[model samples]
Structures are given as C-alpha cells and as structure tokens.
Target: MILTEEIKRIKSTEKEARKFGIQVGLVFMIITLILFISDKGNSHYFFIVGGVLIILGQLFPQLLIIPNKLWMSLGVVLGYFSSRIILFVLFYFILTPIGIAAKIFGKNFLEKKINIEKKSYWNIRNNHYNKSQTEKQF
Candidate 1:
C-alpha cells in the first residue's frame, strides 16, 4: 500500500513537471517569435532551440528533468538573495533615514517618556463616568 501511494505521488510530480516544461518551452517559443518579428540577429538559434524544446516537452518530457531541476534551483537561490536585498534596501535606505530624522527632530511616535526620578511608570486617570459615557464606551 505504501509503495502504491509513493508511486502515485511520483507519477503526479512527473505529470506536473512535464506540464511546467511544456510551459517553459512555449515561453521560449514566444520569445523567439518576438525576436523574429523584430528582425534580430541570431534568432535562428533561438527558433531551433525553442522548437526542439517544445517537441521534446511534448514527446519525451523526462529529458527535460535536469533543466527543470536547474531552473527551480536557480529560482530558489535568486528569490532568497532578491528578498534579502529588498528588505535591506527598505530598512536601510527608507526606514533608517526616517528614524534618524525623527530622532533629530525630537518626535516620539511611541509616546514613551523616560524619567529617572519617577518611581512608577504608570499614570492614573479619573475613572468617574456618567450614564451617557457608559452607554457609548467608544
């Protein structure tokens, strides 16, 4: 039973990978068409490669396994590095300058006040409420 389930999973994964390969081939073909339309040099190579990919993707998709794996690995590595760079840019270029400017201008967004002489940090407010105030708490 376990072997059967594993086989099914593997079959499904292969089917999905085949579909992905076909999609990638179609994209390459589309790029080739665009390049041809623009009359670019070396387009014949792209056309030949794209045609071969499409044919292989349709006939023997298993042959595309290595290329698919390499593409997925590249995407993973690029995604990790791109996300890190984007976050670094956001925090360092955007938020860091805003924080420094706020510090220089004496702007406290969190409303935190520090006093060494104060024993308690809590401030007590009046709790007396009328009936109308209780009815509309917001």
Candidate 2:
C-alpha cells in the first residue's frame, strides 16, 4: 500500500520523538554522572533512573510515546503563551513609543487629517504614468 502524506509525517514525527527521548536520556545520565562525581547523596538514585531511561530510549523507544506526547503538548502550550507575551511586549513597549514619537514630530504616516469643512474624503492622486515607466512593466 502506498503511504499517505500524513502517515509519512507521523513516521517522521515518531522518529524525531525517539531521537528527542534518547537525547533527554543522555543529558540526564550526564547530569547524574556529574552529580555523582561531586559526591551528592541522591546521585545514585538519579543515575539508576537515568540509566533505565537511556536503556528504554535505546531499546524500547515505543515506551517513550506517552512522555514524548506530553513533552510536545507542553512545548506547544508554552510556545503559544510565550509568543503572545513577546508580541505584546514588542507592540506595547517598542511600537507604541515609536508611534507616539512620530505623532509628536508631526509625522503622519497614515496621512490622517481632521477637517470639518471637507465635502469628500477621497484624496485623489495623479495616476498619469510616463511612457518609460509603463514600458518597464514592473
């Protein structure tokens, strides 16, 4: 049977998840080793756990499915919140001050005008194009 695009995508995701699990397991093992070398009391317990994780990740990556799903879900949630906060900071702190400064300097980028006596709101522009400009066809 021919594999669908979604099936291919899911296979790739599973592969990546396996890699992520292995990497996390290695990191934990490294940290445990460091702690052990430092003569930390709880290092043995962490080392045992990290060794188990490394073995599981290497031999039975399927067992990491739940943990992988949970990690991905947490990343998605954190990314959503962090992106909103970053955008809010950029707009409020950076863009707002720039906009206020532009207004103070009488720089109307939007070309807004306040005139009570104006009959029409249309600001007509000269649409006349020269022969050389038309020939360019940009």
- Model 1 regions more than 4 Å off: 1-12, 114-138
**Residue range 5-98, candidate 2, lDDT tens digits:** 3233333345666786778878888888899888887877777777777777777788877777667666666776798999999999999999
Q: Output the lDDT of residue 24, model 2.
A: 81
Per-residue lDDT tens digits for candidate 1, residues 1-138, read: 543343333333455567766787788788888888998877777777778877777888888776776676666667767989999999999999999999999999986888889898786878875789778788
Candidate 2's displacement at residue 13, Å, is: 6.5
Say what the RMSD of model 2 is: 8.0
Provide the lDDT at 32 for model 1: 84
TM-score of 1: 0.71
Cα lDDT listed for each candidate: 0.75, 0.74
TM-score of every candidate relative to the true structure: 0.71, 0.61
User: In candidate 2, which residue ranges exceed 4 Å CA deviation?
Assistant: 1-14, 33-41, 109-138
Give lDDT: candidate 2, residue 87: 100
User: RMSD in angstroms, candidate 1?
Assistant: 8.1
- On TM-score, the candidate that comes out on top is 1
